[model samples]
Target: MSEQKKKIERLTGVKGMNDILPADAPLWEFFEATVRSLLKSYGYQNIRTPIVEHTQLFTRGIGEVTDIVEKEMYSFTDALNGEKLTLRPENTAAVVRASIEHNLLYDGPKRLWYVGPMFRHERPQRGRYRQFHQVGVEALGFAGPDADAEIIMMCQRLWDDLGLTGIRLEINSLGQADERAAHRRELIAYLEQHADRLDEDGKRRLHTNPLRVLDTKNPAMQELVDNAPRLLDFLGEASLAHFEGLQRLLRENNIPHKINPRLVRGLDYYNLTVFEWVTDQLGSQGTVAGGGRYDPLVEQLGGKPAPSCGWAMGVERILELLKDAQRVPEPDGCDIYVVHQGEPARIRAFIAAERLRDAGLDVILHCSADGGPASFKSQMKRADASGAAYAVIIGDDEVAADNATVKPLRGAQAGDADAAGASQQQSVAFDALAEHLIERMTA
Candidate 1:
């Protein structure tokens, strides 16, 4: 007897990583297209950077004490040359790195944006994932608060365009390094007094990153954090002016916001203006988007001092809100599905599909798994399932006459109530098929 074959185990995706399947692709496309158009209207151009970068870039840029660098970065040493590399956890550092390397600021300031995936190893939940996508906007070489207000206003415009509600803005000022230093000293002293109330993460970050501890999520430590010395109290003349300037711009634009003194962003590079767009819809992941000014980051990353402001919004979180708000567009499918049977009919169908496509129509040509044509009934079933507005049916008889049967698969054609029910079909010559479909669809 032949030896029994072994069964192979099924493979699954990484725990926190997820896939965006075909059924959900339309919503993703809609969201991305809306963002693209809105950014363009404001004169922002697109920029893409490598997903992998030298691990040290983030370590020194985002700060080693932060949760992302300390615990979440996906870092590995190259087996080929032993160079340490990391899949970017967040994109701000990478964006700055790219700008410096390319000398993009040589001409002048730039309004740029990026949309891509970011990696971090964390427990995935409702709105959070290990491999998530972000839409980021950066204004480089702008020193004034106008750039800050511009990016914030850009985010507000996006929210309105996407029809999302219940999201509120909160702003704060981190001041300059010296101002934060003074507050850091006082913050450490205060937290140390109530060290017993500090969570493990808070205790560990007490001296190294005291400002972050104020932004903690521990319910038990809320009281201790709220009473800790506020960073705004430590801002000097220049820093306070910048902060107030941003607020005045927001007010003139009628953007409603509150000052959250504890709004120190996660990265170490941020200074001066900081803000977050929060919502109650997504539990625990209430912060859908957040960012701030990181004027010193270019210099910190070995480039000449250049001021920059930017923000990143989580794609999954925004998509979830879109679905929750029922604002998703209809699923994207072909405008026409070509269903045919018989070897000769299939060949004719392929030709017809190409002709229709050449007319700027979206078309799907049917096929069978075993290279033999499926029954007309089976192909029609698929045509209906494709969400196609119409199906072009062909068979041996139609192929002989060089004609195709055009059947409505969706909504009723003008003056024909039963057309959507597939009760209406007409034979059209192959040459005039494209125009015929166009006229009927328009009707």
Candidate 2:
């Protein structure tokens, strides 16, 4: 009796998690490389921590009432140990945990940066994803607003380097905890007075996090929020002084900015200056990057009290802006593509490819997708499609002569004497092939 075969089910990625296909991988590489170089130039070193942590790390550091901890976090119980764990919704809390665990502040202050994926359980949209990547920096042990201004200026420099514009800065001082307490009292009172005007989300956050109510996007509550008590008015003498000092430095450096009274960032740990770099390009999701001073987060997470300020920018959001600005970088194509057929020619092609690579050239050796060697005509088609500048061709005839024909596949490079449409070919001996290709490429 013949047994019936069971059909296999096709699997797909999780709902909001996306794949960075080959077509989009180049842009991601370009963005990451540019950010790495920029952070290095600013004396910021990289620090990477685990993607999962104790669930309490965020509930304690980011606050239990905040949206991230309450509704957006991906939390679960470890099946083996019954311990609570969460895929980090953001990097700042985890960074603080690492700094505390490692005692990184033992020697004065440290300027550190990180880049990796973050997970959030939310409906994915154009610029928002379930799994997103962020590039952030943290400067620990810096008490003054100078560290704050330096990081802000660093962001400005990155924008200029990347040739991006249309993003503007908005700054606000959350002041000290005492000052925020005073503001919170008045803010709660005011919201209660207009309790009838509050929406479901606004009413829910009215008492627990009154400052967030002022940040409501509900058009119906705009008037009530706009008329609410401003946090700036509650800033005490030293808090006002620090805020003013940051402004002076920004003005002297010619960095344009504004102060928004309702700019309480969506986190509980922030205490002093808070700022955001926002853009209109992405529609509702306008904030591309934001961070501020959290002098208490170190101690809150079990480290000795240390002041820290940093910012994190969305990699996907910034890349979208780059495309909107028509600044997408070209894909990285190899300098040479080696195409060969027949067993003897294939062996020689492998050796030639390695030699060229040893000479600091990018090369791709041709091979059949099927188990057999592809035809010469088919291989030539791939060599052209690969975007390689030159094709190193070898066949049975050339293999017997111990030679390979180097032909320009994409026309002449800069400074070459050949016309735009001309193809130039040269036969070179196997022993001197690498040197010959190098000289021609450099020329």
Model 2 scores a C-alpha lDDT of 0.91
lDDT per residue, candidate 1, 362-423, as tens digits? Answer: 99999788886588888889999998889999998899998999988777551265635537
Worst 10 residues of 2 by lDDT: 412-421
Candidate 2 lDDT over residue span 287-372, tens digit each = 99999999999999999999899999999999999999888889877999999988889898999999999989999999789878
Could you tell me the lDDT of residue 125 within candidate 1? 92
Best by lDDT: 1
Model 1 score (lDDT): 0.92
